[model samples]
Target: MQSIPYSVTLRPKIFVFTVMGTYAALAPIAVSSVFQHLLAVPMSVLLTMVSVCIFAVAWIMQREETSFKALNRIGISMILAIALPAFLSIAASIYALTVVQSVEYVAYFQHSLLNRLINIGMFATLSLLILFFIQKDVRKVTYSLTQGYFVGLSVLVAGGVWQFLHFTIGYPMPGFETRAFVHSVSEDVLINFRLTSFTDEPSFLVPFLIDGLIIGGMLLSKKAYSLYAIPAVLVLLLSFSVSGYVNLAVIVFSATILLFARGIIPKKVGLYAIISILILGMITVLIFPQLITALFMPIIGRLDSLFDVMHHSRLYMLVFPFVWLFDYSSINALFGFGPGSYDFLARTKYLSHQGAVSGTSNNAFIDLLFEHGVFGGLVFICVFIGVFVYLWRKRKGHLYNSIALLLWIHLGLTNMYRSDFASPRFWIIVLIVIGLTELAKRNITLSDRRASSSYKKKVTT
Candidate 1:
């Protein structure tokens, strides 16, 4: 068959891939180009600008049909899940002001409301535009997104390795002073003496790395990607992020079991995984003896204190919202206060006794409940379950679908330590997963049609 000549569609496809690819590539790096310190803008803001271009260029070109009806059930479900929180936040903010008549609380509530609205707006806008691009061409978007993200991750992992080497052998790296303006809190990262790479914190770097592992697993068969997994694992260890370790352990363990149960992996695969873990552990201990006390001890202490309210600040933040909820009206329990309201709630109600003026829920699950209320939070949860089930159903004997499922799982697990929804990487992964699902559906439909046509022709013959 002669190859079809390239046409006008080629330009739009190139533009879409470039914009989407650059957006994905920039997710892992947190520092912005223009500013430093107190006035520093995050790279995410720049990414948002990039997203607008995606909408503009696509709108101007009008080469392909775009409509709300183009959205699949999964896409529509996510929009609703996000919309519920924004709606509840507005309603709850109004209700909260009426109940707590303090001028101080009003100021805080307004601030929180505005920020939450922005977060919701940003998430919705990015999701919709990306969904448009995905709907335009699923295969191109899928390949570009996955490849672009892996490239960004590779750069981040390389930076982590460089940081580790500099710390270990005095190999002269750039001073933290240079990164201080870009990094959110350089002092905290400095004090930890762990590898953070280009991210603001060790924990902040974990999610991207976990996603890298997910992508690496997904593309291992398609590309020579397995080699990159080694340095990624090393960098994960070097970060000494407890949340990273915990999330990785859970994901790897659960994935291993699921794959085994499905016969995707033989019994020997389990044994091999065990051996790999032991070997990696032994190698780390031998090379980085400091991890025994620095990494493992802290992990042990944190886990041991997991239930202790005073000792575990994250746990305290997670559980304390309910304290204020119970003190307020029962209706507040159903809808909570509002988005961004947690900061004020934390100050006056949750941690007022300690004289703390600022705090965060830290846990996204708790943030959803405390800010948006139980009803809104449950809406988001239902969306997650729906996406998981859809992906899981399609995951069997499908590599990209399996990767998409794992990534969705990663998002859930990573949120245990993070609550911010406006992050570009989070949405990038979400869009990629959605694209993969849609691509798989399209391929399967075409496959069925082809088979049916063949059957009809055979019968006529």
Candidate 2:
């Protein structure tokens, strides 16, 4: 057999190098700033660039193959999934500038446009990742996110230690501004030794910690896990913010789905998962008696307050978002006003500049509708439906991967930014789901089935 010429061999290498280098540059850019998860910002850019590069590779390698034909529908779905949102935002931006003619409204469109672009960018990048590496080493992306956490943690620990030393020394470092905490007595609570670390406040830290929890969840192997996710579970339970608790729920639920779907989770581990969840629930009850009360009490009491206390008056102020959504022009209705425009107008008009509704739609569903309009919203719904139907069709298998996607779906339904999935926790969990889902997309390959059988054998052993 003759070896391919140096020139021909060099061509493949050149193509691969270009794809990878471009991928590296775009990964971080594609990342959206999902809340305060700083990692999201860079990861998006990296993921996007990488995705495009790999997609090119897929096109090249599969040029003479049947794999492309088999999966082309999914590819098209992915493209349309992205395009729908971008189109909606663009349409909205046009409406805001041309029809509304209001500077404040234009600002909103600007934000809306940028956000849609970022969200589209995310989907584009991920589709590419799957096309490239997943086609080669399916585990490559999974290991990156799981292992990436370890990398991020190492940084967190180092910073923590440095801060610990700074406080110990009373080091009056002037140039370097470090997170500081002070003990303050409040009227409601006793002297609280508050700790402000990094860009995160004590309150925000709850969500941050909860987000890091995928690390523990990924520890689920064939042997057993010692309810290790329990500690993180408890911390999330005791979190003051409802959002923080929700984040925790997302992590656990996703972890559970992934482990169970793969059939690698041991009986001991399953027992631990159930017990751990219940135990964490009990611990939460012990620590914060009024916690649940605080979250729901306001929502519940409103019904009585409207009828009895306020004498059946409308909750007009609270319902400003709903009213605004309807009050906008037909053009604005078809295409959202813009991003910062909504809340910015609210501040200028002095409506609401606080809470989730402060910037975007307070109601996520409505906000999605408002930004993308009906058509764009429909596109989103279709993508979700496709994702859901695709999973449901294969529900009997790939249970773990389905569960992971379910958790993402759960978060998406709740008050979450669509782009939040750009965060490290979100992306890692997503890639994990992707890895597992790919296993289910087929009629159990002999190797995968054998892996599952082997996993089961180890469990019984």
Off by over 4 Å in 2: 1-69, 72-79, 107-119, 122-126, 149-186, 190-215, 219-239, 246-319, 338-367, 389-396, 402-406, 413-431, 442-452, 456-461
lDDT (Cα, tens digit) per residue for candidate 2, span 1-461: 34566666556644554444444322322222332244654554555555556656655664544355444354446456545565656666676676666776656555645755665566555555444555554444434444444344333333334444455565542223322332121223221222223323333334334434443334345232334334434433432334445555665665565556566677688979799989998998779877654544423333443434223211223345444655657766665555324454454444222233244433444555655555555675676567667665565454444444554455354334222322333344445455556544542321324346656344322
Predicted structure 2: lDDT: 0.47
Worst 10 residues of 1 by lDDT: 179-188
lDDT (C-alpha) at residue 10 in model 1: 70
Tell me which residue pairs clash in candidate 1: 37-181
- Candidate 2 C-alpha error for residue 135, in Å: 3.5
- lDDT per model, in order? 0.69, 0.47
Which predicted model would earn the best lDDT? Answer: 1
Overlapping backbone residue pairs in candidate 2 total 23
Which runs in model 1 stand beyond 4 Å of their true positions? 1-9, 31-41, 177-192, 220-223, 268-295, 301-304, 349-359, 444-461
Q: Evaluate residue 289 in candidate 1 and report its C-alpha lDDT on the 0 to 100 scale.
A: 80
